[model samples]
Target: MTEDFINYYRENISKKSQIIKGVNDFLVWGKSQKINFAICTNKMESLAKNFLKKLILLSFLIILQVLIPLNIENQIQDI
Candidate 1:
């Protein structure tokens, strides 16, 4: 699994066109194979969405290195 992930990253860096093509292929394969996907992170949904938006805006930015500032007070809500 680690090797497969590393290969994916290497392929992504080595050629963008290839990376996109491979991603599309993988998606197709996953769908055909009835694979269920889920992303689990410690980050809240709002923060994750905001970070994704920033990443789209600046493709050059290293996503892993980008820090999303969260307002803890606002994040907490009373029901």
Candidate 2:
């Protein structure tokens, strides 16, 4: 299910995803303040990284070095 969603999102990311206005400046400011960004989402790590790469922001992510695991269900299920 997650893979399906991520594949679909990746196909549409070009149209659906975009770098927010002032994001570059904000990131620079954050860097100046010694702050790092951690992107937290249910989205796949690869998809998130690809999107950032498309926006030329992947380098910043390397500095942050926080790629949370891609798939770890948090719900309690019947065993």
Candidate 3:
């Protein structure tokens, strides 16, 4: 059931996703300032990464975190 929802969202809803205003510019500025960013989402990691990639903001992140096998502590340590 969860997989089905994820697949449906990926195909039907994700295509309509939009980047918020000034987000790209902010990311560019943040990168230049040496501020690493991380994304924490309930969404699947792959899906979240794909979403960020589509917005051209993936490169600005130091890590992407989802509730997976790895705990949040481990995820943060990886940064």
The alpha-carbon deviation from the true structure for residue 9 of candidate 1, after best TM-score superposition, in angstroms, is 24
**Tens digit of per-residue lDDT, candidate 2, span 1-79:** 7556656778777676677899998888887887866766544456666677887787665333333443443421111
**Which 10 consecutive positions of candidate 2 have the poorest summed lDDT?**
70-79
Candidate that beats the other on lDDT, 2 or 3, i.e. the better one: 3
**CA lDDT of 50 in candidate 1?**
46
* 2 against 3, candidate with superior TM-score: 3
lDDT for model 1, on a 0 to 1 scale?
0.42
Q: Evaluate all candidate structures by whole-model CA lDDT and list the values in order.
A: 0.42, 0.63, 0.73
Ten contiguous residues with the weakest lDDT in model 3: 70-79
Deviation of model 2 at 16, angstroms: 3.6
Please, what are the lDDT tens digits per residue for candidate 3 over residues 1-79?
6556667766664577788899889889999999999988876666777778776878999988776555643443322
* TM-score to true structure, per model: 0.32, 0.57, 0.71
Q: For every candidate structure, what is the RMSD over all alpha carbons to the true structure, in angstroms?
A: 13.9, 6.1, 6.2
Positional deviation of residue 40's Cα in model 3 after best superposition, in angstroms: 0.7
Name the runs in model 1 displaced over 4 angstroms. Answer: 1-21, 47-79
The lDDT leader among the candidates is: 3
